[model samples]
Target: MKIKLRHLAGKVFLSLILISGLSTPISAQNLISNGDFETWEGISTDTGLDKGIPAGWTSQTGDGNLTLYRTGTPHKGNYSVFARNTSGNVSRMFTPTLQPLSAGKMYKLTFYTRGKGTLANITLTENGEKLNGAVATSPSDKNIFASPSMLNKEYNNGKEWEKQEYTFTIQTDGIYKLIFWPKSTAGTDGETSDYFLLDDIELVEFVDETICTLSEIIVKGSTLKEFDPGILTYNITLAKGAAIPKVTATPADTKASVKITAATKIDGTEPERTTTINVTAADGISTREYKIIFEESNEILREGFASEDRPEKFTYPNKTNWIIDANAAQNNGVFFGNNSIRPKGSDFTDDYFTIDNCTSAGILSFYLKNRGDNANAILTVSYQKTSDSNNWIELKTIPDSEIGTSYEKISLPINSGEPVNIKFHIQKTAGLIGYNIDDISLTPFIATKQENEKTGKDIVFANGNTIHLQTSIPTNYTLYNINGQICTTGNVSGEYTLSVDTAGMYIISLQNANGKSVHKIIIP
Candidate 1:
């Protein structure tokens, strides 16, 4: 009586065997030795072979009607078995006897193949008797198996290499051999130029089927949190106005499949969005799902210098003299993103960039680093009111003593109630090395409402060229002219008055242990 067995296609079949749980514990070990076809014996020369055969494999060439040789063209290794038919007679290549397979235990045989014309027929045999059904039963000397081929034409004929796999279970326990027929009567009639190539063969026993996980998840235009197969949830913060990201998810197992679902709308429509990725194991039953949450950031302006083009909100008067170095990270110990800006030309010259029309009170922050050791290297941060664009007021200055080779964050408070323009100036006194800047960002200032309430009772006003202040407790004060230059700073108790030399709009900052408050005064 014929043994009953099931044959399934490719990797999907492997997954089914694993999920079916018809065998003992699963083993990743490949039962076929020299499966990669890397080692060969019986070679006559470097370029050609005399009856060359792969180790652990034997061949029947029908008395040279079919030629079997080692070819450099391979799917993965240095060589693969190449078979060419000179005559229509059948020729075969047989795998060494495999370890005994138990009845009721599922097994999978996989290999990569590509060629022209009729390729080959695959069969499982025991003691030279067909185990899986056979294709040919005539020509007593040539009829080694039954009739009709197992591999179909759709899978065997193609210019590009294709992976093929077969899964089955035996009815009895015994050693078995896998056979490849280059010209089986069951296959299409062979031609003189018909050829076939084979490599990377594998045989394994299936055990379990619950592998439902993603090996990788990629979101275009954004970086996802570090991926962990065990972690199914992730969060990403996108810049405002950024396009919805495209996601690609890859399953951990080749036999498994993945599907990704992304947000249908743009960012401004919703504050937050969710993208889901689903993975299904080869068994078509075991499954897993992952989620990525995207939210918009609350920054008015942020520039990392990740590209060559200057930011739209910024103006560089000497554009050609500036350099946006792409290899900042390798050149300097610290850098933000991929690039950083620096003055490229003559030393001791001023290189500056200006941000136009900043309308809100905010905190301006950026990274600064000096590449040279010159003591005269300096950076000046300044701002100008929109009404008086010609007059710039100095906010802060960073000298070489404070600047280091590594990047450091510099933050300044903008207390202006009117629109202003911000500027950054860098100067290097005596060397080619200059200052590098990156990661500039402006965030809206959050006022201390409670502190403002406590200081509300304090009266501050200006008349003529003098400013007057009355406070319940001792307070420290700093005065800045519209040009952003410091006018005066002092500590006072009860009442205080300060005189200024010029007439313009001035900013007075009063501070005590409770908090700080800023006031605008017009000096005539």
Candidate 2:
């Protein structure tokens, strides 16, 4: 009964080791003597094991001519084995029992290996979770033995003992299994004439900790302008402390500001405070500063409405880049218009478009239909900055023959503040040319480099000043004052010449059927 009891305890211990080893290969180690490293150490060749080290070890697979020698190796306890692959397409593996690891503790591991393989990957896992895995090099493995220091460096070949080490902290606590596989990759199924050597392995825990730190934040924009009701848009950097629990943005110095109205939102978050607090320094130079609070709410909507019109636009997603006012007659859901509002010879004279300014530098885009006929006839487009009828400027004179007779898109850049107007004058000579204009939207062009910028009121170009205005179709010459009253009109073709003779700040407006644009010019 005493002998039986001892045998039972030994069997139970072996069973526990096997059960744990089967859980995950990465976390399990074959701790038994010679359980891995197929080195036939003390075994003799008469037993069918062909390869034996010069010192005493033996190998049973792949060219049994290789041997395990007592070369005073480190991890292997006093000796190791070396093999050379001259015919290529060769490999070897060893099973070892590893120790357990603790959670949240960093560790360092070291081993020795050498070879010339086109592919190499090392994997290490703790418990059931993977710790680290990475591909070493690409198009590699020229000389497997070049230096003596590479044996322990993890990669590269060497002439002497090499030590490869890795350090990492475990996020989970449990026993881990490690695997080292190196192979010479071929296109389909080629050959490998490389060599690999293995030696002692060591694992140790690390004590130093250096993490949980944050990086500096930055904020910027291209241009800042006031638009529709003084609402500003800025691309702010959501900093580190921003995610802290229960933090909120106050308008005053304590935690909030006072300039924000109750209906206002910061960074698109609905904050408990309603003021334009200096939580952010609003710095316009270099790197601006922003206060991050730990709040359950956000200020800015990730996506929202358009605050201005983009006229320097042509292409778009889904439907064409044309949109119309829902309440407007005709194309209520946004329609397409050819080049000229009216074809060349049709006497259908009503062709016009409008662009509502949302920011200082606005964009207007539309499509033109080339009826496949027309040479020199032109279109007359005009514009005025304010709907009050003052500071009007003739933009361009587009020929009827030039009307959408070809497959193409057109964009016009408006130079003005928010709330400006646009107009188009149609003209043609020979064939019929028309156009389709829609998707007229206005939004602030928030600069990805500048801080939050606000749009300002419409610019006032003084009377008699020369200002450039772009349009979907070109136009003739026209003049207006600050009172929405038409001053002078011209029938010039294609381009407008503005030599107005008045004074004071004013707006030079230009337009086409698609939209309108405005620019501020000073009249001396």
lDDT of 1 by residue, 407-511 (tens): 877756676667788998877664465687887765544344344347565567777887888777889987766544567888988878888887877767677
Error of 2 at 263 (Å): 20
lDDT of 2 at 9: 18
What lDDT score goes with residue 318 in model 2?
18
Q: TM-scores across all candidates? A: 0.42, 0.27
> Candidate 1: where are CA atoms >4 Å away?
1-298, 306-309, 328-338, 345-348, 373-376, 429-431, 448-524
Candidate 2 Cα misplacement greater than 4 A, ranges: 1-64, 70-72, 76-79, 82-110, 114-160, 164-197, 200-460, 465-524
lDDT agreement of model 1 with the native: 0.64
By summed lDDT, which 10 consecutive residues of candidate 2 come out lowest? 12-21
Q: What is the TM-score (0 to 1) of candidate 2?
A: 0.27
Q: Which one is best on lDDT? A: 1
How far does residue 371 in candidate 1 sit from its true spot (Å)?
2.1
